[model samples]
Target: MGPTDTTHTTPLPVVLAGARGHGSWHLANIRRLQDQGVVRLAGVCELHPLDETELAAFAAEPPEQSADFGSLLDSTGARAAVICTPIQTHAELALTAAARGVHLLLEKPPAATLTDFERILTGVRDAKIACQVGFQSFGSHAVPAVRALVRTGAIGTVRGYGAAGAWVRDDAYYRRAPWAGRRRIGDTDVVDGVLTNPLAHAVATALELAGSGAAHDIASIETELFRAHDIEADDTSCVRLTTTSGLPVTAAVTLCAEQAGEPYVIVHGDRGRITFWYKQDRVLVQRAGHGPEETVHGRTDLLENLVAHLTHGTALLAPPHRTGAFMRVVEAVRNAPEPAALPSGAWHTAPALTGDGTRRVVRGIDAAVAAAADTLRLFSELGVPWALPTEVSSP
Candidate 1:
């Protein structure tokens, strides 16, 4: 890992901030791209330096590591940075990278609040550098395919959309870091809820499939937030949106599932429906006059897309502007009251097979989550026994 490759023929040198937690995935991905001659890991900004064991994958040319992010960027001359830091730090770090004219592959939930989202969105727009938010599902080729199907009336006329995510997270999962499940730390907002962070793709994808991925595209939103965990943020939640086009969208997600399974977004139409398991880039279409049809579409990695966008004039996917509508959802979750804790009998702890820790299981959550996506209804609307009253976010 070395200085920025100013020549277009050379690979872009990229620095990574927050090398622990979710950043580890970015580290391995960087190594893969480095092997492909797409980019170089120029430096790492971690509070504590990653030792040889942690840097083993980069043994051939270990990147410089430092605690001071700006200094590391200046010293390494990094042309781009993949930021997977805590939610509250995104705006400042993005501005810092922008000030240096460095491109960004910022992680999901790009900001903790609308103010910060707007700040970073404006700074990067003014900087005019390629800034791809880390909502990787947007890079799925199935996105266009699904959109094309809807446009051609492959699903007849579009009615609405829904998404479901049911994943298991044990008690230890929330203890992974100081900010792991916090909505706010002191006066700063973190908003690391189920919809805002871990399963954010479900929310953003449902909105995008409706051709409404901008701030103005969202006419209004209604949210139902709940948590089985002892932490501040919601581990189980859902949101319903009315787009400017009058299309309906909903996302139901829970980290307290009976079992972990692939998350998906579905488009509902009068004559048919299209289901996209975004993680696997898989799609299934079912309608009248035909049997069920399924296809696995190829996906474009967001970071790789950013590199190609810079070097080959390719279109940028998951750009900041493309996530404005998602930010509105984040804003709503932020202003909503703290997640209502599940009553004692509504959830029970069960030990995980892998032995990480005991997981909290919300009774019938898997079916409830799936039903919301299948019917475009929230948990309460579906009459789940433990659901709280819905909270509406003003337009």
Candidate 2:
């Protein structure tokens, strides 16, 4: 069939594959699309059998088939698939979907390696299908507003930026999932950790807001992985990067602190600073000579925007191509140097195990000891206060 003929005749039915954490979020987005009559929910594909809770959840607005990915696609006749699998499997799943002529909504860090990501990109291009990457913030209101300001010179000649936040994950968190802090996916030594996974969104969002893409110069990036509880990947990281335009950006992420929330980005230009809190969905613009900062709430209409773009030919706020650039930054961070070892006797002491409930207190102490040891090892092997590429320079 001809391109236009194929596009017009086929109804875009979406099958959600690998409905895990972010996959569940994608399912919600799919439901939103169905409610708005933008697309039909064909089925769900997950490796494990659905439990009673999962079955009941789906029964509310059940799909035609909820089975293995290939079976679900065959049974439901879906025209597209949204893959939210682990980082290691992204390339394979995306390539499979492309081969089947299915549109894709792939989660971020497109693949574990540059080669894998490029292969998926080539496949999607060859198939001539719509492929949307899950860099949700790109569709947020704050991104567009900041981009417009930067583009129009409202933030006169952007120079540098800074971002920091405390990311805290406890011992039990790592034990809960096998892939919690792992760099290698199965046997492949893929960089699948905080920088590539958790911090990917912020990195991409910052680049988009700054109106920059892949760095022309070798953008330097450094990372540190800590085992708060014997996990394989780094739980905390501080990264500094320079854009092709010479704008320096710094990002700090940690899963070892107990903080309420993290500050997002602070973009500095000749004119002023624009600060955004992602979790809070708030933006504050402070101009050079301005007395009071102007605040704007970021848009909560990301899913609707995605649907509108796919169904009505509307312009996407964050197209997949732009999203791909962000993934490149994620790769750079993953490739950074491992942190230096920590000195002996420079560790935080645990609280005494003296309480009325002696047994419980003792158990807690044991857990704390284990966690501390793990953290120390992580820092020693993978430096705690690690520096990014920008922090190290030639004299």
**Residue 46's lDDT in candidate 2:** 76
Candidate 1 residue 127 C-alpha distance from true site, Å = 1.4
Q: In model 2, how large is the Cα lDDT of residue 163? A: 62
TM-score, per-candidate, Cα-based: 0.97, 0.79
RMSD of each: 2.9, 7.7
Q: Indicate the TM-score of model 2.
A: 0.79
TM-score of predicted structure 1: 0.97
Q: Kindly report which residue pairs in candidate 1 clash with one another.
A: none
Give the candidate number with the greatest TM-score.
1
List the candidate 1 regions with Cα displacement exceeding 4 Å.
Answer: 1-8
Q: Over the stretch 1-395, how does candidate 1's per-residue lDDT look in tens digits?
A: 11122235688899999988889999999998888788999999999999999999999899999988899999999999999999999999999999899999999889999999899988898898889999988888999999999989898998899999999988988888898899999998999999999999999998878889999998999899999999899999999999998988999999999989899999999999999999999999999999999999988888888888888777888888889999999999999988989998999999974775799999999999999999998889999987867566658
